[model samples]
Target: MLHPEDVPTLREREHGRNLEGCCGPHGGTGPNLACPCGSLVATLLADCLGPWEVRLHPLRTWAHDPTGA
Candidate 1:
């Protein structure tokens, strides 16, 4: 999981059915964010009553350590 601000490439889902929340997206319906290429990649949990975070789909995502650890 990562902060939404950390992953600026993700865009809000086109539809609202997956973005139900009190203040922001609840991300309960499934992946509520997409890549610039329109690929569903993560679920953004920004609901006021829940932990604010973005859960990336592992199978659909890649990790590159800039520090080369």
Candidate 2:
């Protein structure tokens, strides 16, 4: 469990990453540009908590089953 103080709130500005490219890839304002430090922090958190798994929501299917008719 993360400590209350250690866990950053969305309202906090200090927890956000810098757009200046500190820890992220060089040039063209990479992936971290939008959130900056948040990416690194999130990576660390994911590592500590074990590998993260993401499930994509199903997309709409336009084709209907003709065999049923």
The TM-scores, one per candidate, come to 0.83, 0.15
In model 2, the worst 10-residue window by lDDT is 52-61
- Candidate 2 wrongly placed segments (more than 4 Å): 1-47, 59-69
lDDT of 2 by residue, 26-52 (tens): 222222211233322221112232332
Clashing pairs in 2: 17-36, 17-37
After superposition, the stretches of candidate 1 with alpha carbons farther than 4 Å from their true spots are 65-69
The lDDT of each candidate is 0.89, 0.28
Task: Tell me the deviation in Å of residue 45 in model 2.
Answer: 9.5
TM-score of 1: 0.83
Full-model lDDT, candidate 2: 0.28
Number of the top candidate by lDDT? 1
